[model samples]
Target: MNLIRPDKIIVGMIHVDALPGTPNHQLSVCEIARKAALEAKLYHDEGVDAIMIENMHDTPYLNKNADHEITAAMTVIAHEVKNAIRLPVGIQILAGANKQALAVANAVDLDFIRAEGFVFSHIADEGMMNSCAGELLRYRKNIGADKVKILTDIKKKHSSHALTADVSLLETAKAAEFFLSDGVIITGNSTGEAVEPSDLAGLKSEIKLPVIIGSGISNENIYTYWNQADVFVVGSHFKLDGHWTKGVDPGRVQKFMRTVHSLRQ
Candidate 1:
């Protein structure tokens, strides 16, 4: 479990284009893997601190236990990405497939996973998502994947929290910390949206685990969040025209990395 220990880490996102069996699957698995490996290499060369691979293009993601085809395709892509870079690599299966991600991470020797619905219940686009900390941790233990870290997302994106309105974000973070999450992630309402600065401050004050900002980080705004978050997980801003739907633009990645390095100094 000896992972990146920097006070602040910058994670570039490798949103693996839609995999086989998903709605947007356009290329073969080999093609997808090659594209992902290229992106990982680009991030590594650009001096990114770490990288995370996510199924972001798989629109209309499934709930827990995504299709076996999705898992198989991801495993192949992750293996390629891991082999292509030296930096710590993580995986995130879209929707709330925590255990599936763990399985894929374990299979491909990934360092960590971004898990949604690790604690507490909320309505997601997929459906109602119940807390999976108990089942997920037990499964992780049973599968002997303890070395893989699980960073849980609290009050995650693309969801409604009316049920947890009585509980504060800090309280939800506390629940995640109590549940033994290796880290806690905070995101905006949806993808590519900036997280509230006050929310990051509140979570840092209330939680002891590492705090990661999961979306909407760009070269233009890195300085504002550089000191507040332990990790900045960026995706959309690194793509062409700053859109998530586009492919990773190496120039954008380099510019963001330069800004991050300057701020780090």
Candidate 2:
């Protein structure tokens, strides 16, 4: 896999509500891809170092097979997004769908993947997710997709790792590193919620691998975690009216970039 260190990484999030095969919000599959691809292009133009496309708006996500249409649709849109953007691309198929994400990365030439359970799993919005490293790592090998990196999300968004409550935060980071994760991401419990800087600090101390903040970054508290986190994944803040469901907000993107640049300088 091409090296993508976290410190210099700034990712623009593109949320597509529509499932791969079906129309979402009254839009056709092709339309959904067009909108998402265009949004991806916008993020690239805004100077984000990377773009990750997720089907966040698609609700009631299944842990098993997506209909043929869903996979087909995701494949098509992912292809278009790759064509439109010059930056490295990544993908996340939600609800613990690590294999699907790997498949998408392979089909689309995405640089990396954001999988829910590349290591251990706890209760998630979908249910108790089991570890997938066994199946996921082998699938990647079988597909001949060693070039794509897998960026695992530790204690992912919209869920809890309470089942692992007995485990120390630092221990969790150690476990992820031992699993051979290329990188690890830390996110708030839900979208736009601020991740406590202390959590990042603890995770950073335990693992030598690159760490990324997965959500809730804005112009406000970004500086607080700047030193702890190597990469920042931003989405809602860059959306219309700061709404995740709306279109990309160029002004917000520019504003956030300015603040981040100021800090780096």
Candidate 3:
């Protein structure tokens, strides 16, 4: 694995999931593709560091391989978005689809990937996910895809950490560092909720790797975590009227941009 890079402001998320075959999330890939590319391009235009494409809609999560339909749709969209935006591109395949995400990134020349359960087990809405850091790292090296960094979810969303209760969040983060994760992410246990400042503080005390605020970052509280987190993957807050299923709210994205830019000033 390559060394993790800090001192960056990566921001983006996968907001569309109702691709060709899936529709539960109230969006089709066709609807989301052009719109999401335009939205991501807008963020790039605002000078955000990096953008990640994910399948945030294929809900009722599966802890394993997603149907080829989901992967194919994301590949097409990721390619289009990469072409549209100037910043680094990344991908996250929903429901613990790490290998598939890697495959897609490789196919589309994405710069990185967000992997859930990169190390240790977690009880997700779908079920348990065992650590794949050892295998994933080796696989990346084997396939000569080591240049693509893996931003691991230290304590991922939509899950319970009771299984790792004896293990502190920082401890789990340490294991990921040792296992060679390029960076770590902290979530609020679900979408649209901010990661606890205390949790962020605790993890910060333990690791030097790049840390990201994974979910619930928005115009309201992004200021709070801006300096603390290297990147912010925001989605729900950027949607139309604050609804995750609605179209990209350029107004919301602009508001976040203004807030973040003000701090730099």
Highest-lDDT candidate: 1
> Candidate 1 residues 1-265, lDDT tens each?
3433554788889888888887878999999999999988888888888889999889888877689999899999999999998989999998888888999999989999999998889999889999999999999999999999999898888999999999888889899989999998999999999988878775666777888899888888888887777888989999999998888899998888878777767
What are the TM-scores, per candidate, against the unseen true structure? Answer: 0.97, 0.93, 0.91
State residue 148's C-alpha deviation in candidate 2, in Å: 0.9
Residue range 1-265, candidate 3, lDDT tens digits: 2223443474766475566555575556676788768878877876666777877767665786788878888888988888897788888887888888888888888899989889889888888888899888887887878778899998788888888989888898899999888889889977888888888875665787888788888788877886677677887887887767676667777777787778767
Candidate 1: stretches off by over 4 Å = 1-7
Between prediction 1 and prediction 3, the one with superior TM-score is 1
Off by over 4 Å in 2: 1-7, 20-25
Report lDDT (Cα) of residue 152, candidate 1.
Answer: 89
Query: Candidate 3 has which clashing residue pairs, if any?
Result: none
lDDT of 2 by residue, 57-150 (tens): 7777776345666667778878989998788888887667778878888988889988886666687777778777768878999999988888
Candidate 2 residue pairs in clash (backbone atoms < 3 Å) = 6-230, 21-69, 21-70
Q: Which residue pairs in candidate 1 have backbone atoms (N, alpha carbon, C) closer than 3 angstroms, thus clashing?
A: none
The lDDT of each candidate is 0.88, 0.79, 0.79
